[model samples]
Target chain A: MLRRLIARWQGIVLALIGIVATVWLALTDQLSLYIHPGTSWFAIVMALIGAVLVIAAFALTPLEDDHQVASDASQPGPAVHLHEHDPTAPRSVGSGTIRAALAAAIIVGASLALLVLPPATLTSAAAAQRSINSETSTLDQDATALVGGDTSSFTVKDWAVLLGQSPDADFFAGRSIDLVGFVSSSPDDPDNVFYVTRFVVTHCAIDAQPVGVPVYLPGWAERFEPDQWVTASGAIVPNPGSSSAEPLLLTPDEISVTDQPEQPYVY
Target chain B: MSPPPAPLRPAPPKPSTRPRAAVGLSLGVALVLLFVAIRVLAPEAVGDVLSNSVQDFFTLSISVVIESLPFVFLGILLSIGVQVWLPDGFLLRHLPRNRVARRVTVSLLGVLLPVCECGNVPLARGLILRGLTVGESMTFLLAAPILNPVTIITTYQAFGWSDGILVSRILGGFVIANLIGWIYSRHPSPMSLLTPKFQASCAHAHDEVRASRTRRSVAMFDKETSAMLPALFVGSAVAGLIQVAVSRDVLVTLGQNPVLSVFALMALAFVVAICSNVDAFFILAFGSTFMPGAIVAFLVFGPMIDVKMLALMRTTFTAKTLVQLTVIVGLASAALGLAVNALA
Candidate 1:
């Protein structure tokens, strides 16, 4: 009877652990950081239902006897056979207990390390990258503002908003901003010209879309390779005789190669 | 006198029959009570935290489901084809008689079929029923999600050609799948806990359908879809919850140390449980801190084991088999990850 009770309690304990983990994750707001925004609610609802079912199944079932027999039968054949010859077989449980304790300690230690340490360094690195991009883009936006006319269309909502919207503004009236991104081939021009491209992220990087503005400057092609990280400072200018063809254009005044930021992918 | 003798025999007891409606009503009542208790006792502090999380959860879940919708549709159609057009014993005939060859072939086939992790379970079961060996079936089960077309495209987009992340993922997946198969073949006893029911049902279902020539093929498709869809939804939900609840920062933080980082990322893979089709994008988003090798492990290991996979594993294998397989897959994945990192 005691063994049966123990077995039943173990099942319940597993279920409880699962439930607590799920609820804790939900309460932490970390869930959205990993998945798409559209399905998270349905996922939570279904998880709740599944957890309830699992817990109920454990609590209601009087199948401990069957479970024990199955477990015993399923024990690795060599181990069981060896156990049959040794009266000291039951003593092995102490070793199993020790192993379990060790595993628990490791799990706890890791969780603490994750919660407190790495985020600080990673966030700082990401912030440093963002600051560099912002500074360069601010210069370009100022240049564009001088060339075009006014700066009503280029309000910064966030880093992402600023990056995606700047390329569409009318040259000379557009914000003179510094832009930092990886070099990709310019879609409009092929000859020694490129676009400074960054990802426009809607949710996670999965839905990230590429956004860029044309960059034309002397010797710009020689300095930056495709996928090389760079920050370009330039004024937004209208392409000669291509007002209707090109949306917005930039002539870079200065450019510098920077170290690949920790968070290489902006989105 | 003869009639009296006949009447002397006692009548047999009637079998008791209970209405299904009664059972359902009681179940409904119990569920309602449980929900009430949870709602009443739920903490207010947690409520604020959950609001944004709930929103984020819905968003992510919808996006992933939408992205994988095409693959899911194609996979279901393929499953239907396996059910209807493929003749019985077709897979068995194609499968190699030699154990090692069979394992390799099945793993290759797993790469060919472009299904996500959730879809692999049914496909593996289907193949097993068609006479694939246990090791081969398991190989297919592990390899298919990792090697699919969608994953390949996403990996290319993520790491690009410069680092050779895409090629590494494919080759690494193939090697790991085979290694797992080889290990399991050498130690075949761990798999003995898989019940005969897994083998019995497919043949049984096929026989029943064969006997009924008048039944439309659509009927079988519908039946299988209906049975599998609920499990699929449940699995998707579990994956979604994990994604929402666990922070990316948390996962990245865990990836700091070399060995523990690999295990941590693998566990995160199991928890976040993103579909293999779209997981490449997520892994790529993890930033440059995540090693190419660790990302590969996450991609390879996640589809084979996760919350939803666990639920499915329960249906076919005993608890013991599931535990053994989980340990073996986890260890193999970690070792492969270390190897790739070292080579890089």
Candidate 2:
């Protein structure tokens, strides 16, 4: 009885793990970090239904009857006419017992790890590795603040996009700005500028693209370590960034260390 | 009215309740303790070194599973419904007997059933039981994941509504699916390509369902879950690790060459099995980096094959067949991508 009970718990355990993970992410309002805004609600609904169905299986098909059902499901009579269900008929489980157990261990182990650990957001090192700013075009459609009007409203992502649109840095000579991001040293930067980095996620953290604006902190860029969140206020200068065409650099008059935002990733 | 068959047994059933509970609780405790030790002993040493890329990967993996799980269940439910309610007569009656007509009918049927590659496997099995030919069913399996309407609109939007991408994806998927299906029709015994057990038991699905609805559904769910889910976790973990660890700077360098770019993005598509519904958004980042043809290849090939898809496919197909599908899809995508690059 105990062996049978252990074996039957396999599907149930997987279902429960899924349910727990989905519920935790949703309740914490962290589901947005993992999927697109357009599909986040849809995922939540799907997860709810999936969890319910898995739970329902416990009652709908009792543990003792699971193997019996599996036997029935796997039996395709060689006979010309379909015979009614027969337990006596030959059945095949194949090498399923060991394989299902292994799969369950890995899946359940991963789920539990997520629950126990404090959630980690993407870091600056990955931003450097992925080396993608191609999202400047698709990551933001909100930064259409009339070219000269309230340049202060732009974040690092908006500034990155706006700066790329114009040919000469002379276009935005002096625009006031307030921005927040983590610091990562720009590759091949002779001037030693620090890029205020923000990872923009379009659809889940997997597709996150790094975008940043150069901050001319000169001696101060070295004061902070990588991935440390900071906020700065300054005026935008028509200066070329480390890479790409005429990127707007920030001449932050005031800068301070800050805590990470409630949502670290921008949609 | 023969005597009840003896339960199949080899070893005696040992009492496992205490051992099972001990195993579960201790595993949990061990994991918690390991993390807690790291947090306490050298919190500063640990704080920055703990790469959130792994965490973020897990988050994405779990999210992908949860997001798609509903549809998988729905597919299972649909497959079960067909078995219990309408396995015969309904599908066989509507499908044509003519060879070319059947292949075309099912390939176009890809539009109605908008399942991604992962979710479509069970549904394809169900369709086969409903009497689709191997050629017809395979076409649905390959094409539905790539050329579905949801994928269409997303690809359109992902390219910011560039008609070139939209047109090429449909063309590439249709041409490949039809050609593959046609080729499959010539085989002496196409059923030989499927896994041995599935080939044996598939026909009995209807009779089994009729035996008891609960037993059948439970059985079906158990089979589906066991066959696919473990590989899913392993595939996600491996794919995520490689993506995070490997620098994409080479990807950028390769993107500049039209020929290399086609191969590169196709490779990326295979490794990163982003769902077709949302793959466009992923590819949009590469739009500025890679050529139009390369991006097109990424879209065309990604949903059609990937590490996750391979793991899922392992449940149904032989390794030799999997390799053939990969080569066919890869060459087709590359040819289409390169042709576009050369012409336009």
DockQ for each model? 0.04, 0.26
lDDT tens string, model 2, A181-229?
Answer: 9887767562457778888877667777888877876666557877889
Query: How would you encode candidate 2's per-residue C-alpha lDDT over B1-344 as one tens digit per residue?
Result: 01111223311223533444344444434533443343234333333345567655555565556555555656666666665466457877887888888787888876877776777877777777766767777888888877788888877777764638878888888788888888887879887767654554555544543335554566567556555555555666666666776667777679889899999988888766788887887877666778888888888888778887887777677777889888988898899999888876
Q: Report the error of model 1 at residue B266, Å.
A: 1.9
Give the clash total for candidate 2. Answer: 1
Scored against the true structure, residue B286 in model 2 reaches a CA lDDT of 62
Model 1 lDDT per residue over A30-67, tens place? 43433344545644654464355443333232211232
Error of 2 at B110 (Å): 2.9
Candidate 2: regions farther than 4 A off: A1-9, A62-101, A132-150, A219-222, A238-247, B1-49, B56-60, B85-87, B160-163, B210-215
In model 2, what is chain B's TM-score?
A: 0.81
Which candidate has the top score in lDDT? Answer: 2
What are the Cα lDDT values of the candidates?
0.51, 0.65
